[model samples]
Target: MTLAASRQSIPDDIWAKMQGRSWHSDRGCLPRKNLVFVTLPYLNFSGATVEGHLIVHLDVADDVMIIFTEIHQSGKFRIEKMSLVDDYDGDDDKSMFDNNTSAYNCRLTRGGATMSSHGRGIAIDINPVQNPWVKGSETAPANGVNYNTPDKRDAAFRRGAHGIVMPDDVVVASFARKGWKWGGVFTTRKDYQHFSEDGM
Candidate 1:
């Protein structure tokens, strides 16, 4: 679906709050099962897009509202949920070349070298258990394989049927249509739930 359509899925009140603040007119949107996500526009070293996206899940909309209210009460503005996994990698003092995956292995590593997108707060991995990073070395297990081993994940990567339950894919497609790239499409590793403004 187009970005505009995704944007329309955003709750009116949430949209109003996001407008002119955390989100700008240039940002794009994606609609998922009971959620509307707004993606930021930024690029990564792998030519992947990275940006902040507001994820509002219908089931957790109330929780989001509470978080926003709490932030506002504390005099904070433009609040966005920064994943803890992202924070840990940013604070590490080890050699910058370490192949650290942080929370999601969205980062690329060559030998001992490491790369990350969480430092910019542009990419997000949602409900990681449902969407896992299957390594090339091991045969994918059945329980965690949502549709079929790699087929389901592959379909999701291509923006097909298997992506329906993944809110991130919707966000990815929204970004892709706008010239952004999803981490799932990367040649080195497939980050099934990663969506960024840069082309990975």
Candidate 2:
């Protein structure tokens, strides 16, 4: 039950992985200097503890650590898998399909060429397969479509679903305590896996 998170400057090896992927030299993305690498402990559905290496904006690094530490303390939540988006070569689709829970990417938010909180390293997505992005009839990961239907959302009070986020769950509460917005509340699209500083 002893979970931990250590935040530090991006190591040379990880920085190399992010180059041209989540970290871009030009086009004015968030600077590498403003990001911090965090090593965190999270549990998988089977109750196995996994160490997650993540990068997020320095502004949220401490908050992110505390939030996740609370989640680990609860021990009821689970994340199937997590990794840097850079490992997926910056292809968000691939990353989502793999259910790679992560934060930060060098990409614009949908609908325009604007940097999202994620692009600025201020957002995180968790358990994409269980908490998929839903818009109309389609889900981002396709696998998630079966997990988070509107009916299931109403059943959130039950809290039986494994990786799906619920209002009463530690995941939501932990993020909420930090004043971060849950994308699950979005009217346009339901991004259940998302938590961000700006609600984007």
Candidate 3:
């Protein structure tokens, strides 16, 4: 089925939930009209089919659907959950803790002034618990640091662990084919849960 069948402008009710949480008109975010809600079909670790959602820039919405469709067909990987940032009220921490894969949150990098790729809806975070964001001694999702270890990381590629994304995995490959960059390759800090247009 063509995924284009599902993308749409944000409804007023949905926008209300995202107002202060994920989108702020006062901030330098793109206009809501430039964003689209797209459906992503994927598989669970057990190979069960699941439908997901994302709010992304219109330019990348189709790309996101294509990438997820590729990964879903491969059946070589899985995601814990996939939804918009507003699902958790734009709480990145709670989303990570709950392992919610998502895109489009009009926030900055590490809550700083620098806009994140996510702010532009050009980035997506998947399975944050299994693939945490790491910087120095810090790791996101509170309990995911151990996955940074070689042994644990190997489990991801080997499919010994669900929701963990490996560099060579279909999840990464699908996005890569669309010119997105995986955050797992970051030199200073590895953010295995991240994938974006610019690789940041």
Candidate 4:
């Protein structure tokens, strides 16, 4: 879908949700500026709309375009839910890592020194189960610990076969075009599901 159509696709109620200038203490990740809810043409593996809050920035819109285009091009079909992780079980990574899509959760960084990009509304996680976070020997979703390989041969990480987004996928280029960075390219740890304005 084109960018204009994507913008038009958003309904009034959904747009309403995007409004308001109040802080959600429960979901502390709301950005202090340029915060708005954007309903992208993204779909879950089952074909549901992949809409969520994003910073009011061009990069965020472009990133949505990439996800929308990549899925349409891949011709893959499967069952899944793309949701804000915080909505599922607060900030729990274990519960959020199972094939969910989310952005803007108010929370400290993984190491706790500072707020994460998500907390700033500039980062997102797509299909966390397929693109599990790998830190040393630990994986966010303990069940996905064995599916760490970037190789598409693994059913969990398979591209068109199972809806996984790999490093080489067009989705990466999509975000890259907007100056957004992919966590899959992180040097210290691999957060395959993550993408952000600063590559956090």
What lDDT does each candidate get? 0.37, 0.85, 0.84, 0.59
For model 2, residues 1-200, the per-residue Cα lDDT tens digits are 55578999999999998888888888688777899999888888788887897899999999999998888778888887778999899888899999889998878886577887789888999988878888888888987766667686557526666677876779999999999999888998889999998878
Off-target runs (Cα >4 Å) in candidate 4 are 1-33, 47-79, 151-160
Evaluated with lDDT, which candidate comes out highest? Answer: 2
* Candidate order (TM-score): 2, 3, 4, 1
Put the candidates in lDDT order, highest first. 2, 3, 4, 1
TM-score (C-alpha) between model 3 and the true structure:
0.92
| Decoy 4 TM-score against native | 0.71
Give model 2's TM-score versus the native structure: 0.93
User: Model 2 off-target regions past 4 Å?
Assistant: 1-3, 153-160
Model 1 Cα shift for residue 60 (angstroms): 23
Q: What is the lDDT of candidate 3?
A: 0.84
Per-candidate TM-scores read 0.36, 0.93, 0.92, 0.71
Question: Pairs clashing in candidate 3?
Answer: none
Off by over 4 Å in 3: 1-5, 156-159
For candidate 3, write residues 1-200 as lDDT tens digits. 43322678988888888988899878888898899988777877676787888898999888887888888877778887787778888888988888889889988898467999999889999988888988887889887876875577886557577877876778888898999999898898888999999888
